[model samples]
Target: PALHRQRHQFVIDFVKQHKPKKVVDLGCSECSLLKKLRFHREIELLVGLDVNGAKVKKHMYGLAPISTDYLQPTYDQLCIELYQGSVTQEDARLRGFDLVTAIELIEHLTLADVGLFSAVLFGYMTPVAVIVSTPNSEFNPLLPGLRGFRHSDHKFEWTRAEFRSWALKVCLDYGYEVAFTGVGQAPQGQQESVGFCSQIGVFHRIGGRNGCNMLLDDDADDVFSYTLLYSIKY
Candidate 1:
């Protein structure tokens, strides 16, 4: 879970740096990052989207709530909206957020679906900034006893080179500038060469048509049903 902690901190730092007023988190299972962002009063609107309605329902209704120990008494005071939906589909509800994030999420999607998801995220939703993180396939070999992919659900993992190639293409197509970084440590000698255990890409829209007006050109079907889990406004 060290990798997750690293990613969480990395994103938290990103939020601090940008000080976005509105933010959306893709693949926001259990709203872990949302809980962390609650401490920052600058963020006035927080929305979380996930494909799993059941899980969102559980979290919102307290059947499987996120921890509140790090939360202030008024933490629940801010109404965090939750949506059950796929990131690869067009939704009028997701527009105008200043920031969007997908932490360790892309690998769970098929390569073709990855393209669709990209189109939806960059092409349509068109947030001012987007952050994505995924497993660095090249680093898998360095971990003791770990084999194959890092997780059973990952459809395909990408090496650092592969990830950069794809990320560059997305930026070029979407008129965004992107920067790459990593999470977790590499072996002492391999630190500079092999990079980190997780790869991250942050995209900033410079100029281009807002993707909401552009159609998602990929063929992958939208598998998730959009359901309102909860909408609380403080």
Candidate 2:
């Protein structure tokens, strides 16, 4: 549980350092991270997308400002919304955001879906920066009595070497730079080999041509598939 919080903290630290205005959380299951990001004045627009529309609708209300928020409002105006959609599909509404996050989501997807997700996220939506985290299979051995994958829904897990290789390939294909980091260090004596329990990949777009300037065609811009569930403007 502590490590889980650390994974979210890693992302929060990124937002603090970069201060992106428009941010979206891909695969935002319960809007937990969105709830945290809502407190940051730096973000102007916050969006959350999940394939489980019902789940998103149920928990998204937690992101709304509380009574005290109305009394002591100091943050900048914020517009937050939730969407029901798949990450693999292209959504015109989601393109060109400053940041895109997919924490602990890739392993749940099949290998084919992962390819489509990469093309859509890196090649199409093209956020300025993307943060992704997944369970480190190498650390699985240290976990007592843990069997195959960390989660039953997870289709596959990757070792540190495998994840690094895949992240580098995405950078090469999509014209980006990537840095690797993780949380939950391994125990004594095994720390050198196992590394972090949750590995993270931070990808930043290279050069000036990004999602903002790349949107030119009217037909492509008309593509909107995700259903808008709820929105709040403050």
Candidate 3:
């Protein structure tokens, strides 16, 4: 899971550089990244969205435990919200966040669904910055015994060129500037040719809204949306 840790660190570092006050994580399954981010007291609001109702419920009811010491009242003061929703669908309820993230989640969706997801993330929510990470199909051959994509649920994985092409198109369509990077170390002999185990795309919105005006509907469909704002150990 070196790639997992590296992806997490990349996201953490990105957040540090941007210093956003409001943030949203698009595919926050267990809120693990949210837990790590809560340690930063400067973040005023943190929202997590996922497609699975059970996972959202677990995070809300405190069933999903986080590994961090219970301390710091300042951390308790930060707001943490969780919702169950699909990235492919447009939900006007989540708009105006300063930072939005979709780490290691795009490959789970089909190519067509990815288009819809891109529209939702870039057009609807429209955060100041967005971060995404996905498996680099080019590196699969370097992994021992790995014959196919990294995960069974992943519909398709893209090579570095493919990923860059798609990401560049999105940036152009959304009026955002983007940069590419990678996670994990390259294989020994292939270090000069093959890059990292995972690829990342960072997008910064151009002349976009900068406020944190996200509002959640209390009566929103129970199956689609749920909100929780509280603090807990990392």
lDDT score of residue 209 within candidate 2:
38
Q: What C-alpha lDDT values do all the predictions have?
A: 0.80, 0.89, 0.77
Model 2, residue pairs in steric clash = none
Error of 1 at 166 (Å): 0.9
Q: Kindly list the per-residue Cα lDDT of model 2 for residues 183-225, writing each as its tens digit.
A: 9988789877898999999999997334245743556446788
lDDT for model 3, please.
Answer: 0.77
Candidate 1 clashing pairs, residues 3+ apart or interchain: 123-211, 124-211
Top of the candidates by lDDT:
2
Roughly what TM-score does model 3 have, to 2 decimal places? 0.83
Worst 10 residues of 3 by lDDT: 222-231
Best by TM-score: 2
RMSD of each: 5.1, 1.7, 4.5
Inter-residue clash pairs, candidate 3: none
Predicted candidate 3 versus true structure: per-residue lDDT over 34-145, tens digit per residue: 8788666667787888888687667664523344534454454466667777888766556667889899999999999999998888866778999999988888888999
Candidate 1 Cα misplacement greater than 4 A, ranges: 61-77, 207-225
Q: Between candidates 2 and 3, name the one with more favorable lDDT.
A: 2
C-alpha lDDT of residue 108 in model 3:
93
